[model samples]
Target chain A: MAVRAVVRRSFYQDSMVLMSVAARLRGQPGVREAAALMGTPANHALLAAAGLASPEVKGAAPGDLVLVVDAESEAAAAAALEAAGAMLEERSRASGVLRRPRTLEAALAARPDANLAVISVPGAYAALEARTALRGGLHVFLFSDNVSLADEVELKRLAAARGLLCMGPDCGTAYLGGIGLGFANVVPRGRIGCVAASGTGLQAVVSQLAALGEGISHGIGVGGRDLSAEVGGTMTTLALAALARDPRTEAIVVISKPPSAAALPALESAIRATGKPVVVCCLGAASSGAPGTWVSTLDDAADAAAALLRGVSWSPRAFSDPDSVRARLAALGPARGTIRGLYTGGTLAHEARLLLEPLLGATGHRILDLGADEFTVGRPHPMLDPDARAAQVREAARDRDVGVVLLDVVLGRGTHPNPAGVVARAVRDARETAARAGRGLLAVASVVGTDADPQGRRHQVEELRAAGVEVLPSNAQAARFVALALRPELALALLGPR
Target chain B: MTLDAGLDQPLRVVNVGLELFAEQIEAQGAAVDRVDWRPPAGGPDIASLLARLED
Candidate 1:
């Protein structure tokens, strides 16, 4: 194979944009591999490890953008690099002639009254930017990931010392004063507020709230590590206190993947101190919830929050229409192989694993988080590029032991405009591929969205249904439906006449 | 810090890095200004930025 590398000095782009561009280059004809990353030590090390480090890379300054391509021929490699260059040029052209401030200080000078700084730089510099913002008397919404635990702790402490909030180093969802950030849904303003450690977890609950005719006051994301032992629930506690003090937030909801042993007590204490009715969804964990109601699923969290706001009692339901679900599964006949779950949302995938393990055990069920680093290291998030999950669906179809395929389609701003429509094509292709081998594939999915979402919930759901997928109302229900489809007799016995 | 009592002052946002976040805010009918931010070295050099910050 031939390898080519080019370094463009002082050329800057956000990490996500470079990652997506590199992924696109890899898909070109005759390309073996492609990478577009900043010339940081870590990224340079990555290039060396990939065996594509050339003399150009060695000579590159730390501030340069290194583009490398490994292809079957020298001509192919050069052509792909040119194509990548064209893509970057096109982006520059599309941005128009408006000048943008290069430094935070300059930006602040331009907008001195700005209250929050949304930081999405690379993980290495994320904490530095966050620290600058906090010191400048601005709350920070950090959207970068891969930051060190020590930096996260220090940043949160600094924010707390200044009586400000440090939302995340990997946060992807939040809403403040009717403004949505990261991957968020458009919902009406209401009395219920949320503080979550999960991005899609926050989106799922808020979408459910909007569906139930309740809305959100503010949805704060404290990043995934906020509840970890190292971070000690620093931001979670702070966010809870902030929400509790907000006069418009009549009720508060907190979501996470169950806090660490050391952090749980403090979180529970913070909840009790709030003096507001709190609903907590710790994903799959079984906790006493102490001062607040502990729900099992993201959907349940929203239900509880809505009920609290409306001053009504609410309970979790297995499925919206059990009879219909059972009838549909009963017709699908006996499933012969294992259930394979392809998910775009990491938390949703974890929730599926939690729900499926007791019934199918560790060996019988397999769930893949398509959004994980392993799957998205040099590619766009699965929510933006469906190619990764689509490829996985085809792989599952070829596996004779795979009987049921489950998926989660998350919709909102900053996500694919036609997620359901895109996944529908994959579902159709996979089923057709499986049928050609005389094997049956039962596809199940849950679309996390609302009617108010730009993707149009009804339209997305109808698209999935039309593609032969059994569309459930929520991720948990979709998991349950998959369980019933794969082992109808056992699942029915467990439910006991439903 | 005291939480704002309600939806205060039409929600002016300062997006430090990602334009997408600001776009989402704008789509929600809020005022948003993105910083088109770069690293400390005015490039993709996180290593240099981190080294300087450590100083």
Candidate 2:
């Protein structure tokens, strides 16, 4: 195999665009691995670590954009590079507009009444832009990543002092006044407001709420690291204050894993101060009650919020229907004991781990978050790329001790247009790979979306089911089903019928 | 003083970074303008800039 690199000077594209372009290159025959990134220092490091950096890439200026391809042969490498160039050119022409402004000052000058600034630059520059935006009297929706913790702290502090919202440095999703941003779903305007530290977690809950004929007034994304000890949930506290005072939001939902000890007290207090009913889904946090409702999962968080607004009682949904669990276990016969979970959503994966560890033992289950840094250093998120998880599916199928391969398919705006279809092909192939070896691999999966999402939940589930995957109702249910496949006795005892 | 004070108002935005963000805002039927923003000279050093802007 050979490697090739293409460098374009003085060009730029956001991370997701480059990731999508690279995904296209990987789909080409003979392409082994591909990455399309700007020539920033961190991106340079990512390329070097991935073994895709060449002399040209090593010498590239931060203004340059780079595309690297590792292919089966010189001709294939050349073809992939040519295809990548065409993709970039097509993208540029597609956005063909007149001369655009190049600074925040110019933008505000053009539109003096502008109150919000959505920042989506490289991480090295994100904090700087956010600072400028905040100084210019704009609330910031920071959509970049790789920002230092110190930068996040300073930016959030500055925004708070100015009485403005600074949504994210890695904030993936938010909805304001019915406007969706960065992988958000389509939900109607209603009374419940949401503040979340996890992107897909927000999507899962809001989509569920929409499914239950409920809607959200606002959805604030505090970047994934907001609740860390250093950040101390500064933005979360501020967001809670903002949502609490918003008259349109009669109920509120806060979704995240249990926050740092230093941040939780203040966070809980802020929630209580809202004076409105609150639904807290701090997964892994001990269940709590009173002025607020505590939910163990994202689905229950939505239910709690809906119940608060509708004046109904709330209860957590069972992981799965008992009859279905028994039927699945009976179908598995005498299978291998290990379960492999490949997840694109980190919190969902963490939740599955929390559910499975006590039953299967931590080492017994392999629940991999493909969106984690180790897995996504230079690649697109599994939600967008699907290649990494697909490869893992094959790996799981090949493992002699693995009988069940679990998955979570998240669909919405800014995600792959057809994530289930992309994954379905791999699911079928992995089952075939296992069957050829005279072994059985049960693919258990769940869809985190609603019928209202761009990729309809019904269709995505149908596609996965057609590929022979057991499509369960939720991620927790999927994990429980995998547990049942591994150890029926333990699964029956722990996850009895609801 | 409260975000509620502004919740009933029509959305107006100054998207200083990505065009997709502005596009999404417009798609939502709100008014938005894009700012082709880049890192300031001296590369994201906002201490002095923030001091000057706030003052």
DockQ per candidate: 0.47, 0.45
Give lDDT: candidate 1, residue A95.
Answer: 70
Q: Which segments of model 2 are wrong by more than 4 Å? A: A1-6, A20-35, A41-55, A68-87, A287-291, A491-498, B1-4, B14-22, B35-55
Best by lDDT: 1
Worst 10 residues of 2 chain A by lDDT: A373-382
Highest DockQ against the true fold, candidate: 1
Superposed by TM-score, candidate 2 places the C-alpha of residue A347 at a distance from the truth, in angstroms, of 1.2
Q: Write the per-residue lDDT of candidate 1 for residues A1-498, one digit (tens) a residue.
A: 888888988777775678677987898889988888877776777778887677779766556788888899999998899999999888878874147777676777887777788887666667777887787778788877777898999999988787777888778788877777888887788888899898999999999888888888889899988999999999898888888878788898898987899898899899999999999898877766377988998878988888877778898877777778778877877777888899999899999999889877887678988877566543467887777788888889999899889999999888888999888999899999999999999999999987778898999999999999999999998998887776776655544486
Kindly list the per-residue Cα lDDT of model 1 for residues B1-55, writing each as its tens digit: 2243332445556777656667777777876676666556544355446545775
Predicted candidate 2 versus true structure: per-residue lDDT over A21-123, tens digit per residue: 8888898889998878877677888888887777888977666778888999999989988988888788767765335676777877777777777776766
Write out fnat for all predictions, comma-separated: 0.55, 0.52
Q: Which stretches of candidate 1 lie over 4 Å from their true place?
A: A1-6, A19-54, A66-87, A93-98, A491-498, B1-10, B39-55
Judge candidate 1 at residue A52 and give its lDDT: 69
lDDT of 2 by residue, B1-55 (tens): 2243454456677775556667767877888776544334444455346645875
Best by TM-score: 1
Candidate 2's DockQ is 0.45
Candidate 1 chain A lowest-lDDT run of ten: A489-498
